[model samples]
Target: MALDHSLVGVASDPVERTWRAGDVIVYALGVGAGAADPTEELAFTTENTAGVELRVLPTFAVLAAQARTGRRLGDFDPARLVHAEQAFELHAPLPVDGRVQVVSTVTGIADKGSGALVSTENTATDAETGKLLVTSRSGVFIRGEGGFGRSGPASDDWRLPERAPDEQVRYRTRPEQALLYRLSGDRNPLHSDPAFAARGGFDRPILHGLCTYGFTGRALLHALCSSDSGGSDPDRFDAMSGRFTKPVLPGQELVVSIWGDGDGAALFRTATDDGTVVIDRGRVRFH
Candidate 1:
């Protein structure tokens, strides 16, 4: 069935979500924290490290803002939908353990000839204090569900810089990376079940797009937001957004190339070791 355009601009009822220190740590590990060196990133991966307070990764906001009570887009095969873009802005450093009231809205539906891009925005607020915590925006492309004759909004004026990147960071994913990342609330069979993946036209299970996003966020956190002492400072990491241009398989090395855009912002692209651009049109703002 085609997507329900009437859902656009409709906000869902608030849903409350709670997380603990353990949940935060699991999310860290799922995203490759402490993988290179067990001793590194203790603040994010350990809760009992003395003199090192437990901290949350800024990208965790993506999971924190997810709400299952949102309006249904339509009744189409789930395999036909894929994440196309993601963006999130943090209002403050996320607490190690907290409760949030999340509300999601279907922001827009754009026709792209071959497919439809359904965009959504979610806001997670501190349940107790009522303060806004994070705002997340994402788009999903549903194959064979377009051509309704409605044009979408104009695209952003994003372009790659001509010069070389200021810095580049690379990290390798484990063969079991998708298995680990799946523990953090995303149980999509496309990332785990080989048979389900085959239905999606993948020879094997593919890594979660958000998992790749988390890896890229880690590079940005350390390269641009680390403290003078070389410790990752989550507070300095503000906002990030990117488009998923290709699927990433497990155990592939990710190379993040960043070009500084001046005034505490940058543009980036995440590619595989062989130079396949998996995530493109990336942008980030930091302090």
Candidate 2:
């Protein structure tokens, strides 16, 4: 069946979620924290390391806000769904352990000929203090489920600058990267199970798009938001958004290029060593 356009604008009931310091550490490692050297990102990879205190990555907001919507878009093969875009804004730096009440809404369903783009927005608030915490927006493209004849939402006016990027950082993914990242609650077979991946037109399992996002987020966090002491400061990171243009296999290296866009923001993109852009139209706002 095709997607249910009626689902648009429907809001889900509040779902509460809680995360511990351990969860944060696992997520950090999932995204390649300290993979190069355990001692480098001690703040994120370990909760206790002498004078260094543990800190949560800004991208952790995406994982923290993932609560069951208790609603389905429509009937279709799960493999047909692909993460198309993702963005999140942090109202405040996330704590190592905290409880949150999350409300999600199907904000839009646009027709894109071959498939439909279903967009969602999630708002998470501190359960005890009732203060806003994170707002995340994401879109998924469902192949073979479009042509409903409805025009989708307008695209953002984003264009790359003509000048060279101010900075570029590269990180290599381990061959077992997907295996580790899946532990962070996204158990989709697309990132594992070779047979399942083959069915989705992949030679082998591909890394999760969000995993790539997390990797890119790590590059941005350090390049633009690091503390005076050279530690990653989540407080200095405000928001980020990006579009996934290609899949990344495990063990491939990722190069993140950032251009200062002025006004405490920057435009960035992630590519492989061969210069194939995988994540494009990226933007990040920081202190």
Please write out the lDDT profile of model 1 over residues 1-287, one tens digit for every residue.
Answer: 56888889889999999999999999999989999998989989999888899999999999999979846799887887889999999998899998999999999999899889999999999999999999999999988899898877898988999999999999999999999999999999999999998887789999999999999999999899878766989999999999999999999999999999989999999999999999999999999
Q: Which whole-number lDDT from 0 to 100 does residue 55 have in model 1?
A: 90
Instruction: Provide the overall lDDT of each model, using Cα atoms, as 2-decimal numbers.
Output: 0.93, 0.92
Model 2 residue 9 distance off true place after TM-score fit, in angstroms: 0.5
What is the Cα-based lDDT of residue 33 in candidate 2? Answer: 97
lDDT of 2 at 63: 86
**RMSD of every prediction:** 0.9, 0.9
Clashes of 2: 0
Worst 10 residues of 1 by lDDT: 70-79
Tell me each candidate's TM-score: 0.98, 0.98
lDDT of 2 by residue, 99-179 (tens): 999999999888898888899999999999999999999999999988778877678899989989899999999999999
List candidate 1 stretches off by more than 4 Å: none
